[model samples]
Target: SIPTSAGSESDAEQLQEEQHARSVLRETFLRCLLSISNKKVQFRMHEKVKVDATFGASDIDVLNFQVSDLHTPIGVQKEALIRCQDVISFTFDV
Candidate 1:
């Protein structure tokens, strides 16, 4: 039979590996955000609404994105914070 300590040790190792993976993913995402800063982006939101804006910055949690020169259906907004929940996707040119 396998020892209980052996199972616990493996569990701890797995947890550490998972944490490392998460850290890497978060770092990569943050880098992508940085690269997109100051670039023009097109956001596809709910109800098929789309808008163009200059990417500013994203909150640490990525819950919202700060933008500039937001061109909405109505008119242009000088600056805005777009909720991530409202956005289905966004794209920018490299």
Candidate 2:
């Protein structure tokens, strides 16, 4: 059954609240990323692989990360792009 406009005022208020919450969360996340920028970070990946890199920037969608001085088992890469899907976890000092 189609919902009438009778309850739309309440529905609109609820939607506005939800939008505000999402905006706040996104802003916080962006701030966190800013703090990590230009910092050394350790990444834990699948297959028990681990590496270190200087954080650069992440795409808006967070599909990948641009990093510098990536230290891998083979050697150090001057610059690289890491797929977020390949990363299990990452950490850095505040």
Prediction 2 global C-alpha lDDT: 0.96
Candidate 1 weakest ten by summed lDDT: 1-10
Segments in model 2 whose C-alpha atoms lie over 4 Å from true places: 1-7
TM-score of each: 0.90, 0.88
Please write out the lDDT profile of model 2 over residues 1-94, one tens digit for every residue: 6656567688879999999999999999999999999999999999989899999999999999999999999999999999999999999998
Q: Which pairs of residues collide in model 1?
A: none
- State the weakest 10-residue window (summed lDDT) of model 2: 1-10
Q: What is the lDDT of residue 42 in candidate 1?
A: 99
Q: List the global CA lDDT of all models.
A: 0.95, 0.96
* Top candidate when judged by TM-score against the true structure: 1
Query: In terms of TM-score, how similar is model 2 to the real structure?
Result: 0.88
Report the lDDT tens digits of candidate 1 across residue range 1-94. 6655656777889999999999999999989999999999999999999899999999998899999999988999999999999999999999
Predicted structure 2: clash tally? 0
